[model samples]
Target: MDQTTLNYIVVGLSFALYFGIAIWARAGSTGEFYAAGRGVHPVLNGMATGADWMSAASFISMAGLIAFTGYDNSTFLMGWTGGYVLLAMLLAPYLRKFGKYTVPEFIGDRFYSTAARVVAVICLIVISVTYVIGQMTGVGVTFARFLEVDVTTGLLIGSAVVFVYAVLGGMKGITYTQVAQYCVLITAYTIPAIFISIALTGNAIPPLGLFGDHTESGLPLLTKLDQVVTDLGFASYTGHHSNTFNMFLFTMSLMIGTAGLPHVIIRFFTVPKVADARWSAGWALVFIALLYLTAPAVGAMARLNIMDTIQTGEVGSPEGNLLYAERPQWIKNWEETGLLSFEDKNGDGRIQFYNDKNADFASKAEEFGWAGNELTVNRDILVLANPEIAQLPGWVIALVAAGGLAAALSTAAGLLLAISSAISHDLVKSVFNPEISEKGELMTARIAMTGAILLATYLGLNPPGFAAQTVALAFGLAAASIFPALMMGIFSKRINSKGAIAGMLVGLVLTVGYVFTYLGMFFIPGTNILPNTPDNWLFGISPASFGTVGAVFNFLAAYVVSMQTEEPPQEIQDLVESVRVPRGAGGATGH
Candidate 1:
């Protein structure tokens, strides 16, 4: 069969499989809907967490970002992965032991203030909504590429799939669905990397292949990559060009944001015990590391491959570079989306893909009868087009389509669940209708979920950035508003409800403001006060790194406010002490 028919066949099968799993695992009660009945196995929950945690940002956009920016973007890999250590050691078991259905519930109960819970719900909603935009966008991109549909249609179809599984199955349905998704996504991710690795370095293991000698160049893979890219006037593939302090802050923001995200934390609550939560975090990391380890290799190899393709002959020669007529099929496909463009700057009919910013390179380009760089590639296309670029089998390309969708859909479902639970369980039932029936609450949860899907889909259609960049902003907000509050609630018994609420407000307000000032005026078009550039950053901290600063402000504000206020009630203090140990951990029984 041709690629399009094969793509439909493979992608159709995956969707059918997911819908079937959702139907088989439909949730029956609020408990099942919220936390999977608290009976999930540790290993299974771990796999589910891996799927939940690795969104489109991780699977689709990350390696591509690294491919274009080189080592400067390693912050993404380290920040996202390192936060799991914090989750495993500091947050997951304690939250699991607290036996709550939603993150705000823990905050409200721990602080003994309904106001604290309400603030948490707002923060959760904000973080989750922003995060889901990326997933929605990813789904749209995947559909537009493989299914040849428009982004709006792709988003609607994706939202329908998520609504079917997430609304019907709740956490129960999502957990098992995510487990199957993890398998599909990871397989899709690794198979392409393995093929590319062997093709580049004669090594099957991607990480080893990243460092291994290139079969053709007889130099280390990275060494060859650095040489090729720099030869094309780009920075060395291994060099770090971003500001040092900003990189550190950016990395810290991602770490804190990862540890603080409500969706990942809720996965631990589904497991049977506190011990299970801990082990599940480890297992989740093991699964996550599989992709993390291979990503650098994929990025590096893809960059090298792309460069080699464009620069087929010696630079500065009349015959240098691939002619426009000789452009590959992958380029043609992406060009239709406006993601890849060619300008033919010199009207030479040949494409010059190079760094025009390098003065030395510009002078040489003049000598070579070249005007400037002519090809523009979107960073996201690196991973998406990798299989096609390498001329891998039609099935492999189709699998990438499925994998990208699976990653986006799984995480979108998880975020929507978090948002719906916050509204229905935490806001509607817990505070507004304390006497609401379990059945009424479950129905409300499903409704809230449907509403959230509509809102997120709308936002996804007009996302502020690429899949990963949009998600990173959400992380910054999470790090600022949620993570610090949870840490103080557990580690500092002296922090009062007043202090916690104050911290979240300050963090949320300031972080959102900072992000908006650069992103746009509340993300409106052409409304930003300042351009989103490094020169306009605060103390050299980019908006992506501003989360760390917000977190620090949260810590200080909470501490300072607590010093001037009354302490938490003695009973609340004891509740804090109880969760610190794993002895009394049991299945979560109540909302």
Candidate 2:
């Protein structure tokens, strides 16, 4: 069969499996819809959570980020993964035991304030909407490339598939589908890494192979990579060159942000018990580490591979040249989708694939008769294109398409689930329409999912930033706004409604304003303001890594406001005490 046909069969079958699961495991009620009726097996929930957590961003963008940026991008790896540890330890079980439908529910009920709930709702919507768009963008990109459709058509199709399963199965359907997605995505991700690892480093294990000896250089893979990239203008693969302060802060931000996200926190709610929540988090990490460990390895090796492909031959040999006409099929395929593009910026006949501005190395390459650098590969293509680059079989390539779709869809569904529940259960049912019937509530939730998906689709068509950037925005907002309130509600009893709301608004405004100044989301063009480089940063904090500062502001604001105000009522303090202890937490009732 042709490659495109095979891709279609594999992708179509995978979606069919997801839709089938949605049908078979359809939720019977609002309880099942929102929390899978709190009955998911811990192991399965762990897998689902893994799939949910590792979205299209992790599957598609992370390795590529690590690949091109060298060691500095480790913030993404550290921040994304470290967040889960925070979730497992600081938040997950307690939130799960609190027995709420959404994060806002926990905040409002624990703090005993409708206003607090409204503030939580606004934060949830902001974070969840931004996150959902990223997922939708991923889904569209996967389909546009593999399903051979336009981005718009692909997005509609992808949105429709998620709607089917999400609306039908709700949490129950999504949880199981996510387990399947985890299987598909992990297999798809690792196959290429394993193949390329053996091909480049002669080691079977990709992770160890990263540090293992390279057959060509007889040195560690990272050692060879650092040498090659530096021979060009790139930073060392295993060395650090960015601001340590910002790196540390960025990592902290992603950790708190991850713990704060509504979709991820709600997953813990489905596990059977508090102790199970703890272990389930460990299992989720294990599953997540499968990709996390492999990702950097993939990034380093893929960077090395591209360099080797262009630089492998004798300096003047035609074989040494990266020719536009002689490019690989994967290059052509991705180019067709506009994900992998090169301008031949110098317009030389040959594709110059090197860091030309490496003042020291530029002179040597010029003496060697090379032209200016030309290639500009999109980082998002790294994970998705890895299999094809490694010469993995057709099945493996197909599996990647399936996996990318799985990752994107599962995450989109999860975010939509979070958005819908916050609206239907927390906002509408809990605060606004307290007299609504259970069936009416469920329908409202489904409708809200539909609305959220549509908005996400529109925004996804032209994503405000890269997948990771969008996710970071979601995390940043969650960190600045929701996380502080949730954590204080659990850990402190003095914070009143006024304090929480005011603190959240301040955090939200500061973070959003800073982000907009750099992102150009609010007014003037982002680049016109500053370069976002070390030389231009405020207090050496990169904009990409400034959420930690935003979060600290939140903490300070909440505390200051709380101390100046009346103490929370005795009943609210008692409620806070009840949530902190372990005995009746798993069995607590109502949002």
Candidate 3:
């Protein structure tokens, strides 16, 4: 079968599977819709959290990032997974014990202030919406490439599908959809990796193969990649190329960001008990590790493949780097979407793929009759194009597209659910309709969800630059704002309204200002007010890693201010003690 036909069949099967699951696990009440009725098994919740946590970025973009950038990009790998360890150890079980339907609800009751919850609601919306846009963009990219549709159309289709399940079934719908998504995305990720590892190393496991001898070359795969890339004037793939300090900070930032994210936290709220939350986190990490462990291998192998394609006699003229005519079928397919572009800058029919910034290679390339670097590969295409790169079957390629969409759409739906519930459950129902009927409030929640989706869809289509990047700001906002508030609410009984508000505002401002000014996204030609470089950063922290620092500031500020002011009220203090212990409450807390 042709790739496009296979794509349709695979995508069709996935759609049917998700829609069917939505039907089978359709939520009837607001409780079921928002928190899966707080009756979910820890194992099942872990799987759902895995899917919810690994969005398009993790499935599609991350390995490619590590593939091209080498070990310096390992921060992404460590940041994302390491944070889960922190979440499991520090936050998940305690919060699950707190039993909130939404994060803001916990903040509201814990701090004995509506303002605290409102601030949390804003931060949650910011984090989830930004996160959702990236997922939406990933879905569109996958659709445009595999499903053969314009991205605008793809986004619309993606949105419509998510709307149906998410709006209808709520958290119940998203949780089950995520389970299927995790399976599809993980299978798609690992199968090609296993094939590539077997082909190259005679070892079945990619991670082991990564360190094992390459069968053809008789060298460790990393060593081979490092040698070959450096021979072509590119930095050694296995060596440290990026600034070590910045990379360390960036990795730490990702970890803290991961722990701070609200949507991931809410997943724990659905578990049956405190112990279930603890075990659930362990299971989620286990599932996540399946990909996290394999990602480095994929990176190394893909880098090796790319270098081998570009160097010494693959495609270009007898003297030139790979010729334009010799482009792979996968490259041709990706080129159709304008993601992989080749301009033949030298007017030679051959395409030069190299590190243009390598000053030492300039004179050598000129002598070799090469023009300039011609091949441009988008990082997001790495995973999507991996099956094709490995000469996998048409079904495998098609399956990858479905898997990418599933990962993107499922996470997007989870974020949307969180956003909608924050607005409806926290704001509308909690504050406005303290006396409203359960059915009436559920109706309001559905309406809120629909409106939230529409808004997100529009924002996603033209997202702000600051808003779109994953791991850093999205997680930063959560950490600097929501995570801090939730922590204060739970651990610090003395955190009064004044302290909570000031701490959140301070954390939010410092983190946002640093990200915006240094990232140069908030304004055109930003002030260079603060250098993003590690040496120049506050306390030698990478701007990417600054959220953890900001979170610490929040903790300190709240603690100091609380000591200087009043304590949490007697009733709220009792509520804190009740939440601290894992006594009763099989249900998630709410208005």
Clashes of 3: 4
Q: How do the residues 1-591 of candidate 1 rate in per-residue lDDT, one tens digit apiece? A: 989899999988999999999999999999999999999999999999999988999999999999988899998999999999999999998898888888999999999999999999999999999999989988988888888888899999999999999999999999999999999999999999999999999999999999999999899988988888888889888997879999999899999999999988999889877778888999999999999998999999999899989988887777878988988998899888777899977888999998999998888778888788899887776788999998999999999999999999999999999999999999999899999999999999999999999999999888887889989999999999999999999988999999999999999999999988888864766888898888898888888889999999999999999999998889988888888754444443222
Clash list (residue pairs), candidate 2: 83-255
lDDT of each: 0.91, 0.84, 0.80
Error of 1 at 480 (Å): 0.5
> In what order do the candidates fall by TM-score, top score first?
1, 2, 3
Sort by lDDT, top down from the best: 1, 2, 3
Model 1: lDDT equals: 0.91
Predicted candidate 3, C-alpha RMSD? 3.0
Q: Ten-residue segment with the worst summed lDDT in candidate 3?
A: 463-472
Model 3, range 1-591, lDDT digits (tens) per residue?
Answer: 778998999998999888988888888998998899988888888999999988888888788788888877887888888889988988887787776788888888787778887887888887787687778778777988999888788888888889888988889888988898899999988988998899889999999999999898898878888877776678887777666666666666677778878889889988777888888999999999998899899888887777676575633346546667877888888898877888877686776787777899877767676677778888778888888887888888888899899888878888888888898899888887788787887888888888877876776665433222454567766777777777667776778887888788788878878877676654234555765565676666655667777788888888888899877789888877777764555543321
What TM-score does prediction 3 earn? 0.93
Looking at model 1, residue 455 earns an lDDT score of 98
TM-score, per-candidate, Cα-based: 0.98, 0.95, 0.93
Cα error of candidate 1 at position 199, Å: 0.9
